[model samples]
Target: NTTAAAVAMLRDIPVHMSYSIAVIDRQGNYATVYVNPDRPAEVVERRVSTNHQHGVEWAWHAETTKSVEREAAVEKLLLASASIKDVLSGFQRPPAYQIQYGHDCGTLYTAVYRPLDASVELVWPGSLWRQSCADFQDEVRTIRFNDGGSGGLAPTFKEGAVSS
Candidate 1:
């Protein structure tokens, strides 16, 4: 019911471009809705989008290699009970994970949400943080980024002790 309500809410919003939204209820039931100006909203169990429309069949709409590879990786990740760490660790290379350069798109952060526990986990360069709706903690920390192409972990922060 919640997923249906969420989908209905998206239908009322004005869309300027193609995008997908995944909603999961507390019961672990989820719905992924794809919306585009070219066609009606569609529901899929899993989908990936990147500046390309999936609603309409356009000869010009090409799926980037990045998107294709990611889609396949995501499919494998989704098949198992993957944790936030599992998902984050899965994207270990270019396209899915990029370091910001002169003017290229770089992955800033990855977030995982748990509807049942009302919790969210986030991963940055070399840092991992998680918080629950019931026990939110705010702290100041620094993360360093390795702009150089060294095969070492960069943008790392000291693991601070977390209290519940």
Candidate 2:
């Protein structure tokens, strides 16, 4: 049910280029929703019924070696979201942030959102779809980073920031 909402959000977003899109639930589980057939097939989704090895992994961690101008663009874009504002309000108190990477012409912002807990949550959303999501799973994998106190999505937090 939640996966369907994520997919709907992807389709509603307008993009200039073809790109694939995927979304991870609060539990770090991912499901591919958009796949650009124009691009080469990368992440192929499998009908796994209690099977753990059917889906392709996502590039949960990444960096553009060529310094794409998209990084700055993403930061600026995310600043517009309510989530960023909430984090910036108390970034130094606890839950230190380590920016990973982002994409788009100032459209996508990807990074970790940590609260009182040491664990972190990967939050990214862009204005453009880079390509169909056909190869996304193969190209990206859910990244697990050890930081903060416990891991969780902070903006939509609970129990005064986090819980074990």
Q: TM-scores across all candidates?
A: 0.68, 0.25
Candidate 1 C-alpha lDDT tens digits along 1-164: 48878888877777887787878888877878888777778777753443333433443333323445455566666566358567667654454555543234345567777888899877775566888889888755454444545453333334555544
| Runs in model 2 lying further than 4 Å from the true structure | 27-29, 35-164
Model 1 Cα displacement at 132 (Å)? 2.8
> Candidate 1: where is the Cα deviation over 4 Å?
47-65, 80-84, 137-164
The candidate that achieves the highest lDDT relative to the unseen native structure:
1
Candidate 1 at residue 140, lDDT? 52
Positional deviation of residue 17's Cα in model 1 after best superposition, in angstroms: 1.6
Best by TM-score: 1
For residues 79-128, what per-residue lDDT tens digits would candidate 2 score against the true structure? 66467556443332112223222332121123442222323433432111
- List clashing residue pairs in candidate 1: 144-155
